[model samples]
Target: MSRKATITQKEIVNAAFKITKKEGFEQITSRKLAAAAGCSTQPIFRIYENMDGLKKDVYDKAAAYYEDYYNDFNKTHEVPFVDLGLAYIGFAQKYPHLFRLLFISGQGTGGRSMYDLVNGSTENVVKEINKATASGAGNAQQLFMQMWIFIHGAGCMAVTGDYDLDEASSVAMLESAYKAFCLG
Candidate 1:
């Protein structure tokens, strides 16, 4: 009789996620995943059909992370909107490899644009933007689009290591963009 498999899907994904977090998705070899999971390579294949399957699982986890947890920029800054922008750049600087996977290489999201991810994932902050801009929710969304342009630019530059901006300057630029949108 064949032995029953014991490893779960969550375990496999978690192990892959950890490796991807540190080394980017390319490091997710069968041996590395097995070592991380404390199991043989057989179990990884048993749980996932192939590396691409495992990658898709990890990609979902990463997407959910930015959508839910990594977006908490409010703890550092009084203004949630500012926190949101700072958080993007900080995430890029902190996770340059992962940032490239998410934004630059377009590993996930099925060719959806970054603006879609920004707009879709950022509905939580519309209320804060509304309050800051003293505008209706409709106008606040427009403001978010403008602010996102600045934030996304900095984030792209951050991962490229081309423009190493300090916190003060980033905040000033975001504020300026916000003000520009609010004016008209």
Candidate 2:
């Protein structure tokens, strides 16, 4: 009779996710994952065809974690449009490992174009921008894209430790970008 396995695929994925969250995706070797999961490397190989497969699952988990974190920030903040950008930079500041994994490594976007990436996921953000700035759909979208460029740049800088940004400064920059984008 075959022996029952003590660990599930979900458990292994969870362990990988934790490792990736704390130490970045590059750290997730089979041996490391097995150690984190308290199992042998054989189970990891049995569950996943290779490390890419495991990393894909870990990427999905990291993406979901980011969505929840970003959405929760938007829900509570008074200025969802500008504040959302701050929250993004804030995520990079707080979770440099996860931020690098999700954004810097370019794994999250897959092959999607920037247009689809922003427009597809950020309809509500556009709506909020429209309401706040009284701009029409096209202008709101343009403004969102413009501000997102700044926000994403700031996030990258934060993740790379290139810039040490404080909330007050980030908020000021976001507000300025919002106004500038609203003009053009």
Candidate 3:
């Protein structure tokens, strides 16, 4: 029998993910993925029916990476909610292409809008905000949504490089806006 193949589907998908991270999802062509994977385009076709299938896998990978990256601060920080907000903005600034793919281009919503996805994921965040605001979690939905809108705006600006935000000022903004939304 012939020797076993050297590369696997996961490796190929990971290479595609790296390319998506650097160049955005739209740039994930067969050639680009092949170049990133350090192999010919044959492996891509051998593993996936087409670029779309590979792209779908890549999207799933990126979503998981995004969630993991954001959730990393869940236990480390004293103020996990504000820390998560800062992490969101930091992710945008650090990975603009991934940010565009995840937030602006809207490639991986699975038929749901990003707004819906974000709102749906805010259950835990609402609980955190409730703890911070001394309000009940059930009552913090609107407050969390408001904070999300602002935090996401800052991330968008970071991705676009239109505004250079400093941490101190962002912290101040987060504090004031959070207080207003949570108490008002």
Q: How many pairs in model 3 have backbone atoms within 3 A of each other, for residues 3 or more apart or on separate chains, i.e. clashes?
A: 0
**Candidate 2 residue lDDT tens string, 107-158:** 6546643333333355556556766665343466566667778878988888
Query: What are the per-residue Cα lDDT tens digits for candidate 3 across 1-184?
Result: 9766777999998998888888887888888888888888887788899777877787777766767776663434444256757878888998888777777875764675555434335455655665665644345667777778888999999998975868777777777777677567
What lDDT does model 3 reach? 0.73
Clashing residue pairs in candidate 3 (N, C-alpha, C atoms within 3 angstroms): none
Of the candidates shown, which would achieve the greatest TM-score relative to the real structure? 2
Please report how far candidate 1 places residue 183 from its true position, in Å.
4.1
Across 129-162, the per-residue lDDT of candidate 1 in tens digits comes to 6666554434776777777777788889898887
Per-candidate TM-scores read 0.78, 0.85, 0.81
- Candidate 1, clashing residue pairs? none
lDDT (C-alpha, whole model) for all candidates: 0.74, 0.74, 0.73
Top-lDDT candidate index? 1
Quote the lDDT for 157 in model 2: 89
> Which candidate do you rate higher for lDDT, 1 or 3?
1
RMSD of each: 3.2, 2.8, 3.2
Write down the TM-score for model 2: 0.85
Which residue pairs in candidate 2 collide? Answer: none
